[model samples]
Target: MSPKASTRVARGIITFLFIYLATPIVVTMIYSFSTSWVKTILPNGLTLKWYSELVASPEFMAVLLRSFSLGLLTTLIAMACFLPVVFYANVYNPQVKSHLRFITVLPFTIPGIILVTGLIQLYAELPIPKIIILVLAISLLSLPLTYQALDNAFIGRDFRAMFEQALVLGDSPFKAFVKVIIPNIRAGVLVAMLLTFTSAFGEYVLTNLLLGGNFETLKIYMYRLMRSNGQASSVLTTIYFIFLAFISLILILIMQHYSAPHKSTKEGAKK
Candidate 1:
């Protein structure tokens, strides 16, 4: 094929893929407000009744809150655990970075179904809280992406210059990290936070398997009830998507803001 034709074909394929990916989202959103609930064609009209019913359901409401709390906790813990490792890998030891990266990505390469099954058997033998176990399981899935994002953001950065800049201005290493490196990669941090939280929040398989019917995240709740109440399930899914999308948008906005030239201001203070 001619280069021009190939380019056109590629664009067409890209468009097709986007639409294909988006089809389910659009349909679900439509069904969230769908009234007729049943038909060969589209719903007769949209309504808010499904959402009202969803909000009134106590079990799902609690699940939604639990999911949020779990996601937030996971994001915080993952950042605490991974951030320093990323800095050390990038600044002090680039040679071992490859191994660290592999460790993060390994979980993803393993089939989740198999992993969850293994976790289920393992958790059954432990004395930990099921919710905590489930949260950790989901966080493992998100850790690699978070590590990569922060690592990528700092790839071309000069840590020595950053440290010097902070020190001259009266900053300790801890202060420098908090004030300099963290601020510089605020975008990446925000991206990582949102991505990690979303991954943990929406995770269903691990939560279901590890929690073992003892608890439910929002996704688990949605899955359990979707069969008996399609419209209500659709509404819950829509609300979840909306909330996730909003968080994602805020992350995108943070990235845009930090993309400009910004200096590190957190140095040389009271340790």
Candidate 2:
């Protein structure tokens, strides 16, 4: 194909895909604002009552708080468990990364239902809090994303030399890593944390099964609303979609902010 024709074809395909994926989200957003949408091609009337009711409820606030806590704790635990391991695997023993690949497919292979069943069998009678087990399990599930992001941060950079130089300059190993290595990988860490947090926030199966609905997070609440009130459920779903879009916007901004410096340097070198 000619260059112009190929460009037009690519743009056409992209536009079609964008609309295809966005249609359901658009309909849901509209439904959330509609007074009624039954057996009709379009909504009966538009109103904000659903959103107002959802936002005004104390239960909604509690659900948000619980989900936020889950997301934050899961992110922290995932980072604590994986950061050092990924750094060591990447900077010192590259061979270990081969074994670590198993983690990437862990969720697929084991599945949440099986994992939860095992947890129930193992820790059902234990004195340990199920909340602790829930947090740890969610963290473990998020590890593959955290590991890959941290490992990629080590690429094209001599982190070992940086660490050694910092150590030689009278910094302790932990201090050296915090000061020298972390700043360089801050963007990747942020990306990993965001991904981990999002995964843990929307988690349904494990949270519902493990906590037995005593700890109702956002997803569980949404499910409850879905069975009783469709309008409220739509509103919650829209809010969740907005939250994910906000996260994606942050990721894009972080990528652009980091890439701009490299682009400028490349142009300067060429000049």
Candidate 3:
């Protein structure tokens, strides 16, 4: 095929792919605005009643708060607990770095239900509270995602150069990590937080199985209300989607801002 023809075909394909992916999301957003329930094709009217009702409901508010709290806690804990160790593995321990990767990924090999079941069984025999166990389980499940993000960021890094520079400047490894490495991997850390938070926010199987109706998350609330076909459930789902979208938007903005400085610095050095 001619170059012009091939370019036109590729553009067509790209447009079609975007539309295909966006169709469902667009439909859901429209449905969230619908005023009528059980419509065959689409609602005849659009109104904000559903959204207002959702916001006014105490149950939904509490559940959303809980979900946010848990997700944030999980993200923070995962970052704190994993960063130093993984950074050390990559920078210092050449032999064990490969083994550590496998160990981190092992949890992903098990089915979520089975993992949750095992956690519940183990928790029953231990002295810790169920809530703590549930949090730990969720954090464990989230580690692989964080590890992958941070590990990729750590790759192509010049640890030796960074350390030597820091030493010449009379800075410690910890200080260098804080000053240089952290800024460089801001994008990866944002990705890790987004992934971990989203996963923890939507994790119904593990939370439901572990808590057994004793605690309710946003996902659990949505699941329980799903069969009723209530407007409240739809509104709740819409709110959750909105929250997730906002987070993604913020992460994107952070990546843009965090990346711009580094690019500017590189160009300055070149000049």
Candidate 4:
């Protein structure tokens, strides 16, 4: 085929794929707003009642708060545990990255059920709060994503030289990292944090098993709704989809914002 025809065919396929994937989500969103969608070609009526009812519930607010707290705490813990280690691995000792690669297969190697069972066995009788244990476990699960994102941020940059220069300029190592490296990799850090938070926020298995549905995060609440109320559950699912879309939009904006300067600099060099 001619190059132009080949490109046109690829574009056609991509458009079809996009529509194929988006159709269900679009239908779900419509259903969330429908008064009654059962046994019909279309909704009987469109109403905001479902969304309003969901948003107005105290339980909804509580569940949202719980999920947000879990997401935030997990993100913080993941950042603290992985950021410096990732920095050292990428900048000073690339060899450490080889050992760390094992982390990428963590979920496959140790499934959530197995991990939760082990946690229960070890910490079930401990004096410490299970919430804390839960947070730590989620953080551990998120490390592979955190590590990879932060590791990628170090690419195409002379971080060792940057760090050494900062050190030579009389800044302490922590201060230098905070002042220098963090700004440079802010985009990646934001992406990593968002991914970590999203993972923890929607986490069902660990939260459900560990807290025994007593914690009632968003996912657990959604599960409960799913069993009892299809309309409400659809509303919740639509909201979750919106939240994910928002996160994705933020990530795309961050990438574009950060890349613009590099693109301009490269163009200037080429000129």
lDDT of 4 by residue, 118-147 (tens): 988998788989999999999998888888
Q: Each model's C-alpha lDDT?
A: 0.81, 0.91, 0.81, 0.91
- Tell me which residue pairs clash in candidate 1: 170-268, 171-267, 171-268
For model 2 the TM-score comes to 0.91
lDDT order, best first, reads 2, 4, 1, 3
For candidate 1, give the lDDT. 0.81
What TM-score does each of the candidates earn? 0.84, 0.91, 0.84, 0.91
RMSD in angstroms between candidate 3 and the native structure over all alpha carbons: 3.5
TM-score of candidate 1 on Cα atoms, chains taken together: 0.84
Task: State how far residue 58 of model 1 sits from its true place (Å).
Answer: 1.8
lDDT of 3 by residue, 162-215 (tens): 866887898887888888778767778888889899888887888888886788
Worst 10 residues of 4 by lDDT: 259-268
- Assess the local accuracy of residue 169 in candidate 1 as a C-alpha lDDT between 0 and 100: 93
- Give the Cα error of residue 246 in candidate 1, in Å: 2.4
Give the per-residue lDDT digits (tens) of candidate 2, residues 1-271: 9999999999999999999999989999999999999999999999999999999999999999999999999999999989999899888998989989886668667888899999889998999999999999999888788888878888888898999999999999999999889988988999999999999999999999899679999999999999999999999999999999999999899888777757547756988
Local lDDT at 116 for model 1: 75
Summarize candidate 1's per-residue lDDT along 1-271 as a digit string, tens digits: 9999999999999999999999999999898888875755877988998888878988877998888898999999888888888888888788989899889988879887888787768877888776676667777788788988878878677986887789899888899988788876776777888889888888777777666477778888888778888888888878888898898788777766666454233232434
RMSD (Cα, Å) for all candidates, in order, is 4.1, 3.6, 3.5, 3.6
